[model samples]
Target: MLLLFLLVLFTQNYFSHGDLIADTCKKTEYPRICVSTLRSNPDSKTADVKGLVRIILKAALGKANTILNQANDLLKKTKDRLVRQSLNVCVSVYEEALDEIPEASVNVGTNNFEANIEASATIDIADDCEESFSNSPFTADNNAVKQLAVVAVDIIASLG
Candidate 1:
């Protein structure tokens, strides 16, 4: 009986994340990233679609802040005025993204279309930042936030 109970518990734990995160993430462009990230968060073990949006948006916000800091740090180190200018552009968009993410978080399930618009902006922010670098941008960081934001937007659309 104990072994059967354990097996049931294990299966419940496994399939909880499996079905919820899987169904949602399959709708995203980057399914692996979405599943891995959502599964990494303890809260996601039981999260509904709205809860998942909160988690992804939070991750996007953190990554945006990290990339903003990287751009600022590079800005200070560079001697070339052109590189500094590009860094400035990155810095600006990241700041704009920072503002949008919080708003997105607030609107998550209430009016998901609003959340979708805000989440959509993060993808553009990453693009603009990368374009400004013209060479080396926060490739990984930007990709992380962009993919997370895209996932959030797609999920938000699903809610509405």
Candidate 2:
């Protein structure tokens, strides 16, 4: 009897995790990316919606910080004044976006509306960064930053 009970409990938990991932991913614009990224994290196996958003937000922030660091490094390597200026702009914009992530995470617990707004603002910062390089030869970096921003936006929209 105890063995049967344990089997049932384990089955329910396993199915529940799958269901939660499906439900959560369905809410996002990029369902595939959402599912794959969240599933890669062990915590998502048991996290509720808010917890999942928090995780996504943290991941987005990490990406933004990475871009910022890359921009800074590029600035040091490039001697052209225009390229250095563009990289500096990217660094600053990413910094602002990174600042908003914690605020968004805080708001996620009690007010998803505010959290969404904050997240949307973060996306805008990324757009500004991309636009800053419109005439520059940094298309690859710009696209990479835009992709990260889109992921962050998709995660925010999922909170709805």
For candidate 2, the 10 contiguous residues with the lowest summed lDDT are 140-149
Query: What TM-score does each of the candidates earn?
Result: 0.90, 0.85
RMSD of each: 2.1, 2.6
Residue 37 of model 2 has an lDDT of 68
Give the per-residue lDDT digits (tens) of candidate 2, residues 9-115: 99999898888878877766666766776788888877887777777777777767777888888887989887787888888888888788889888886777788
What's the true lDDT of residue 150 in model 2?
58
lDDT of each: 0.90, 0.74
Which TM-score value belongs to model 1? 0.90
**What is the overall TM-score of model 2 with all chains considered together?**
0.85
Local error of candidate 2 at residue 157 (angstroms): 5.5
The candidate 1 region of ten consecutive residues with least summed lDDT is 130-139
List ranges where model 2 is wrong by over 4 Å: 135-160
